[model samples]
Target: MLWGCFSSAGTGKLVRIEGKMDGAKYREIIEENLMQSAKDLRLGRRFIFQQDNDPKHTARATKEWFGLKNVNVLKWPSQSPDLNPIENLWQDLKIAVHRRSPSNLTELHLFCQEEWTNLSISRCAKLVETYPKRLAAFNGKPGDLIVINRLAYHHWAIYIGENEVVHLDPEGGDSSSSLELLSFRGEVKRQKLTDLVANDSYQVKNLLDQRYRARDHYVIVKEASSMVGRQLSYNDDTYNSQHFARDLRYGEAESRQVRRAACPAWAGLAAARAATNDFSDRRLLYRSLKRLSK
Candidate 1:
């Protein structure tokens, strides 16, 4: 597992946990990194630390350490992940590191650290600026579409209420370590919104509401819940997470990402230009297009 933190200023130190992290190890990490990170970010002594209520994080020793250091800790709410903007950074970091496809533990560590450092301060500011929007809370009702920004792509989920969602998850699962590569096979899962999103920025988006009449909320919830244990075929070039969510909401499965990949932007531009009669010399244009394609 990785432990990282970021303020509105920018990212802090990102460290890999070598083994099972107990209270002592957790305290040690905070002792060694937290103050230095705060100093590096220039948060000053008044910045309040925010952390989940994990047992290790809130352990007696850990609390005492914070007290001794005169650290102020934010009283984070349970199951309310949307309040934390750092989760968005974590999501971006994971995507950036995974794209590198680290060969081993060494490369994984290097990539994680490098990517953390490479996170732009501007992006952090944007996340903080939009903090209020995320704070509107998971105001999504049952059967609403929840879209999580995954940097390069969007992950969709069908909200079933009570802070739970049903979504397509990769069969390979999330890589807790750099060794695991993401795969295309998918499984439908019903899990807490916080757990599924896990520090990622998300918004409740029922984009097709105006385009297509929505099915009854009860029916949508029932159908989505029934899919909890089902295994779904997943191919990036065909079906994917967006397709699954759209199917649940619209009764039709379509993947824009797949369509885009099939006909790339350049290919579409070339086709459109080729169809136009405005070109001075069609043969010259064709020759240039052929060379570009090559």
Candidate 2:
């Protein structure tokens, strides 16, 4: 889950986000962000949200939570992320988040807040410029593409059947898979039906389904249409629409070039970029693209 705030000398600030892990709605926080952004606008001035179509963000509940305001949520492409700019910034933020080594939520919050304030504007702009690369990554393999993390709860895994592998998952115990890796975490390795079972290094077979608690744990990257697409639409009414549109263009381009395209993060970058575009702020745009291509 991620939250983004856009600020400018003219409009003050606006807040937006992708959502939370459990998918819980945070109206108070959302409103707080809006109110923060609203600080800059004149009492009657209008600002946009550039919201995505995540259903969670656009549901009647969200509208009710936001209530009536001078704010307008923009319409954006349904599943495009390759072009959204903020996605790129969020990636850096996540990397920074992962690197922070916070002991608890309070520490994490403080670190995150500082990071947010210190974020460079040049990096934000490059996120928009790197659309070509994003489109390239998604040009193929567009369906049911699992992120396939290697480190389960930051550890290794086990083996079970032919073509099946297992893991000690974060949710709790062990899990195995014949079609794909266990739900826990592991790098994607193409092993033959015989070889997967034969690997000597791994502990072969957990047998108990109940033992594998983390087997059900999955970090959803895309939705039925595409996580990227939904994020593109999210906050289109704010400032991420252009980023989403840019992602849509990349997705379309990749589809044309290869026939498939996946990689939801690219769309997140598109959203970030759109936010920057919204206020005509070039803060992080330049640097973001450089980091993305690398």
Candidate 3:
């Protein structure tokens, strides 16, 4: 879900959250979502001004529908100042979500929006002074900086609040990195080790994904067991039935020999990098930054 920022501080209060959403909806759909979130703010009778850069749809299919007389579409900076506080606010809000599970998705969305309203503007201003940290991160190891960040538990936060920017999102949503798992899993060291294991669950996941790819290339077929062979089946058809592929017969006895070697989490990370076929140092850095920008 996406939400818009509106500030009553005249023209200065702007909502600056950056996130990615999929698919395209009609302009009315976009406006309706924003309107609903606006209502969620409980702003009462105050006239909170809202502005946005020209979204593609504004000039396309739903242009007329969205050209409301009161709505203002402001011009945007090619590269805006790091002084904007909402940037840091977004980081902290994400951190909260990454650290704890909300009651549900509705609660999660409301919590983030509430955090934004409650964030201290003064703290976000302080982060503006640290803008050099970002420039330096880019200048010194523009390449390595992203790698260090990407490999972090999730990702680092640059928290923006009423005044200070709290760095957030140290890791990510998947097994490769789990900020939530690390925060609540167990002792830091033991949890780190457990997270590093990439358990049977993870292996089977990879196998299933690989099976689909193979099928696309005509390397596999669709029978219960045709996933890896022309005719195959397993006692547990539940997982296979859902994925429409054969389950890993770990009992195949061949799986037991799987180089079951593992080291400390940090060392394991290094080994993972070396053993992984797709972990290109530069390519990964490029991809990581691109992902953040989006």
Candidate 4:
């Protein structure tokens, strides 16, 4: 097997593994070849390391090495080969090598080196650039909840798939608009997937199934869409995007009792209470504990 790393600027060193590679062996190769390549390419501390979830790659020793070196490893999902650019590079290399019609192992190795060298920097950069789009596509399933934390506040949106999301916007006008027509703080609007996630870090909450009993996704989406352009008071406690999401999923009324300051955290707690059919404020703490214990 062959192991390599590349960046938008250029390809890194390619190391050929002749036999079985354990965690230690893999670490050695990374330390020797990969680290040297990074240094040679002047990557400095700006690059993020990407690796699959192979046992050897995720071994405790390997993780400790990264921590000691202060290396930032990209969090990758398991069994997601489509998101790994290196996999595509390997396929391209294989195709290039086969075209050479190498007759022996030495010739095959030579062909691989030549093919790896021939991979253009622009092509490598293009592959790297696809990372975001791949990630967006992976999480762009219908009815998926996308949450963005903007330090002092949090925002919520429902992914409609097809690179679009339907979200309640406080500043949205009373009309339907495309994703491109809406801003982060705009009124309830449908916007492209990219606009929602521009530069902020987001998470696929996927909490619908957990918070409420499974329902037809189409039904949930339809309900979410019906709320588009519908005006609701924007109170952090009673009516906000989180409340909007809960109402769409659970069909429950927002809690009006203002026992504390309104915030997304409080909204979430209220939603959790509603999920368990516990809407009363009487002995709230005990009731919540009992429901949780059950």
Q: lDDT for every model?
A: 0.74, 0.38, 0.32, 0.66
Q: What is the TM-score of candidate 4?
A: 0.47
Per-residue CA lDDT of model 4 for 1-294, tens digit only, reads 888889887788998896779998999898888778888768897679988788998999999999888889988775442346666677678779999999998998889988998999888888788777766655545676777665335677777655567877665533233322111232577776556555445677755465456446788788777767666545433456765665555555322222233454555575455355333222233334556687
What TM-score should be assigned to candidate 1? 0.59
TM-score of each: 0.59, 0.38, 0.29, 0.47
Q: Write the per-residue lDDT of candidate 3 for residues 154-259, one digit (tens) a residue.
A: 1211111111211111121122332221121111011111122211111112232332322221122112112222221211111111122221222222222231
lDDT value for candidate 2? 0.38
Order of the predicted models by TM-score, top scorer first: 1, 4, 2, 3
| Backbone collision tally, model 1 | 1
lDDT minimum window of 10 residues, candidate 2: 145-154
Better of 1 and 2 by lDDT: 1
By lDDT, the best candidate is 1
RMSD value for candidate 3: 16.9
- Where does model 4 exceed 4 Å of error? 78-82, 140-294
Error of 1 at 68 (Å): 2.2
Candidate order, lDDT descending: 1, 4, 2, 3
Our tally of clashes for model 3 stands at: 30
lDDT of 2 by residue, 12-64 (tens): 23233444532244566666666665564333456556555676677777776
Clashing pairs in 1: 87-199
Native-to-model Cα distance after best TM-score fit, residue 193 in candidate 3, in Å: 32
